[model samples]
Target: MTSIDASKLKLPLQMLLMGSATKLVAPKTKTVFIEDLPPEEVAKHAPEPAGLVNLGNTCYLNSVVQCMRSIPQLRSGLRAYVPPPRSANSLAAGTASSSPLLLSSLRDLFESLDRTTNAVPPSNFVMATKIAFPQFAQTGPRGQPMQQDAEEFYSNLLTVAGGEMRGNCLTAGLTGGQSAASAPTPEELDGAENLADALFGMKMEETLTCDEFSSAETAAAASSDAMDIDNNTALVEPPVTSYDLHRKLVCNIQGGSDASAQVNVNHLSEGIALSLSGKITKHSEILNRDAVWTRTQRIARLPPVIVVQFGRFYWKATPDSQDHAGVKCKVMKPVAFNGTFDVYEFCNEKNSKGLEEVERCSSSGGRRPYRQKAQGRR
Candidate 1:
């Protein structure tokens, strides 16, 4: 390759460089080599008079510092950036010098990178120089982290502040002998009719997907008056919201706790829950035997749990008591019933000695023992 000899050629700005360097005007130079000046070394030799590095030296060294700081991560990544060997490699690639703004722009680039990216010197130094920085331009809405930050910020806020209610469930408190309506439980707010859910951080969804809308199909059935009216006598009680229900006494019977627990649904909503003990009877004895016969009389009889769930669902409560239907919303949670008894053939009862199979009485809403399959419920 053809080459120019540095020894014989006159360099530009030679006299102004004014540094200790071998200069000459000879021919047949043996070699040409690049001597890199470290940024620190250049800074050390900047001409004191110009208030800038030596114009020639300054350009080279300024190029080094400019290349070092141009990385957004480098300057603000730490209290002070120290370029690592990997960062210095960028200078060898000569990327920063292409732009005239390189030196003036580097320090400012570090200022607005994510604040979490900033740290103390040694740790920040490696992260800033060795890794590429994320684009954190604050120029437009798309460039900002508004969506991610708002979600994270609200999540943190909920953790600190309490009193968020979800659905009909309650984390309510028990108190003294005050009527449940106005009882002052801790964290209790007044009538739900008076409050808004958005105030509780329940942000509105802009659109409901098809599946979300379909979930409301069952909810519509639940929000009706069918369960409350007494024409159908059954034990299923209405469901409740946290606001309308309150604890009056502690009766810890089932759970081995003297903890008195019962939910009063005086102002019962569309939801209701009830427990009652009764005998469940099917209309025909033939239907029971036929169902059993069709199934090949499985195990000589039905496994008793099936019979009990059927009994509980079908039990006819005494019509005098109010039938409080559970809230139709999410009320489909199967009603809780303690089935601690086995089914008995109605004729096999010890309470009836020599009882007739069918006892008939006059039609004044009186008792006529019909041939019926009954499940004794409690």
Candidate 2:
């Protein structure tokens, strides 16, 4: 190689050589100090609501979950839920049930939806639902997931949620220094501690009266042969009153003899009233024979939230059909409902009085309603 002294070279040549040398080396990246940079004008945007992506034919699951998510109280309650502590004895015994896993999966799903605006794929939730409910795990002939009924799924989901809520309350009570001996019964806990029941349960009173038993003794005795009643059947038998707690109220869409008439809010109300109070023909032990039993139901305790499921699907007589000559059809009636639903008419005396008091306070601007007063930071 020919030895060249760069120091002996001309200034212009040296400058040219230096420029070429600089070109050969990598250029330094521009340093940007966060503080030195101009104040960033980040476009502030409100968080848009996140949605669930359908995992297979899982729109039923998505719809039901979204409906539950719409309830802020339920969401917050589930977030605060603490899973029951697994006993060493139980763990050593065998694998645990998948029931509690549904609640955890649901909580995680809600958290994920809350944290991001992106569409969340509910694969875990779908799997959890399948494990929790076998009915939801039904598949089509091609092995693809089937489209299940949303209403049925909703009921099942609530049932699972209620179970989880009970467990949560039980765990909380135990952890808070409460002993098993002093702990409240399941029925007591339902009204007091179970979050699901507190939100959606309705304590119903059903009074079943035997029509034949209400008649005069002479008339009853005369009609005894016709009704197949025993001659010694009591005429003044007391009405049988029973109580039950229901999570949802079903409203029949089709009512009365008119099938073509459009069902409105008034019709819906009538259907609910009928459901609450209906007549059934059955064998009555009090009458000692088959008779018409009139069942009247009243709401003893009303929940803060009420779910009214419209009975849309029904079996229609189809003479042309080969299978059982009947086909399942959906009533696509446009049900008109008001935003404000007054359940005072359906409430019992005590609940009605409480509602009246609430209305009176609300109208006078004296105090908040019972529901509002009971609401906490959550």
Best by lDDT: 2
lDDT of 2 at 171: 42
Predicted candidate 1 versus true structure: per-residue lDDT over 1-378, tens digit per residue: 899677887656344555656686567865632235544344435442112132211232222332333322223222232222334666778643222122123333333222122221222321232132222111245542221222222232223222222212121211122234543333333322111111221111111111111233433433243334333333222221111111111111221112322332221110111221112222212111211110000011111012111111112234465665332121112323322321222212321222222223354453343223222221
Show model 1 residue runs off by greater than 4 Å: 1-149, 161-237, 243-378
Clashes of each: 27, 0
**RMSD, every candidate, angstroms:** 34.3, 12.3
TM values, all candidates = 0.12, 0.70
Winning candidate number (TM-score): 2
**Each candidate's lDDT (Cα)?**
0.25, 0.68
Angstrom error at residue 45, model 1 = 52
Q: Which stretches of candidate 2 lie over 4 Å from their true place?
A: 1-48, 85-95, 167-193, 213-234, 255-267, 317-322, 364-378
TM-score of 1: 0.12
- What's model 2's overall lDDT? 0.68
